[model samples]
Target: MPSAHRERRRVTWWVALPAALALMAVVLGLLLLVAWLRLLPDALDPFGTRTEDRTGPALLESIQDMSRYEAASGNFQVVVDLDKDAKFLPDAVRGSRTLFVGAGTVGAHVDLGGLGEDAVTVTEDRKSATVTLPRARLGRAALDADRSYAVAKERGLLDRLGDVFSDNPNDEREVHRLAVRHIEEAARESDLTDRAERNTRTMLENLIRSLGYERITVRFAPPSG
Candidate 1:
């Protein structure tokens, strides 16, 4: 019985020895692989990741012909301070304020599409001509989203809670609207229209000169109500 037990023990040891060796070999191979990956450049890695763009194609929208001549564009920057307070409530309970820096551009254009048949008058010899154009007007203010930013924001306890549950919590549309209005007002106060008129006149004069017109007169029509 003793001899039989010794034989069984020897067999078990032989089986476990090979299993342990195989496990050690596997562990050594994994360590070597990790070391190689770390030491080698990513370009030589067989398991390196690849980048691909899977974005969908862009859809084209409606297109309109441009008839107005954009003569001048003014860049504007403004600091906006907007406050919202609940009626009959203290600011600590229900109030919000934002300090934002906004940037935008306003364009002045001459509407050549409104010209009538009598807008241009030429002498019989065609040596001189007079061209009338509509007064330069300002276009919509285009806000620069990349350059505009919020400097600071303050919200009351209730306002904070509302933002936490609101779907459009960070909506800055009101502030943007105010900024645009302010920019438009500034543009109106500026001489951008006068500059646009001068530029348009220069362009027309050059064009008429190229056409062999010795004398060219450019006039702007009165602004209609």
Candidate 2:
């Protein structure tokens, strides 16, 4: 009986050490887990958030605020019809598009501030003067939102579906851009620059005549290349 009791005691003593060591391991593991959790970032998931910087919008705003002095303005209207088809598929239209009727104004200008000391010539008596002005050039084109509008629009199934997952330019800004482009082209082709030069000549002639000068010569400088 005493031998049986001693054998049981020995078995219990052996089991007790392993159980205590396992409990210590478990506690240490819990502490390590708490320390690891503290090292994680505050914003883990990027869902439903914008990660891009805001430099683009700010740049567009700066562009819109700039202006230049314009001498003559030409008003024009054009129909902007565009169609985009899938690049790999048949020629049938199947993509996003920007279509509109656009009305805008283009201006021509001459930088009078660039005139040199020889641009104006005066007689010794200050009775009459001859002035030469700089050549006229095209200015920034502007779109009138009140007169510009979308005529029609058709989007492909794929493009419409992709709108939900991506960022794309809408019709308004692109339409205005198209209008400005065409207006600038037309202004370059038209006689707006000549008209600007003529207008400047007439204005200077009148101003000199009003200053008691009987003869005033106002000429535009030859166009620069």
The best candidate by TM-score is: 1
Q: lDDT of all predictions, in order shown?
A: 0.92, 0.77
Per-residue lDDT of model 2, residues 1-225, tens digit only: 999999999999998999999999997776566556654343642222346776755344344433333678899888887767777865333575667888888888777777789988999898889998778888778888899888776777777677779777655677677778888888899999999888877877888899998889988778777
Please list the residue runs of candidate 1 whose C-alpha ends up more than 4 Å from where it truly belongs after superposition.
Answer: 1-57, 169-171
Q: How far does residue 68 in candidate 2 sit from its true spot (Å)?
A: 8.0
lDDT of 1 by residue, 31-137 (tens): 57965667646676555567989999999898899999999999999999999899989999999899989999999999998789999999999899999999999
lDDT of 1 at 175: 87
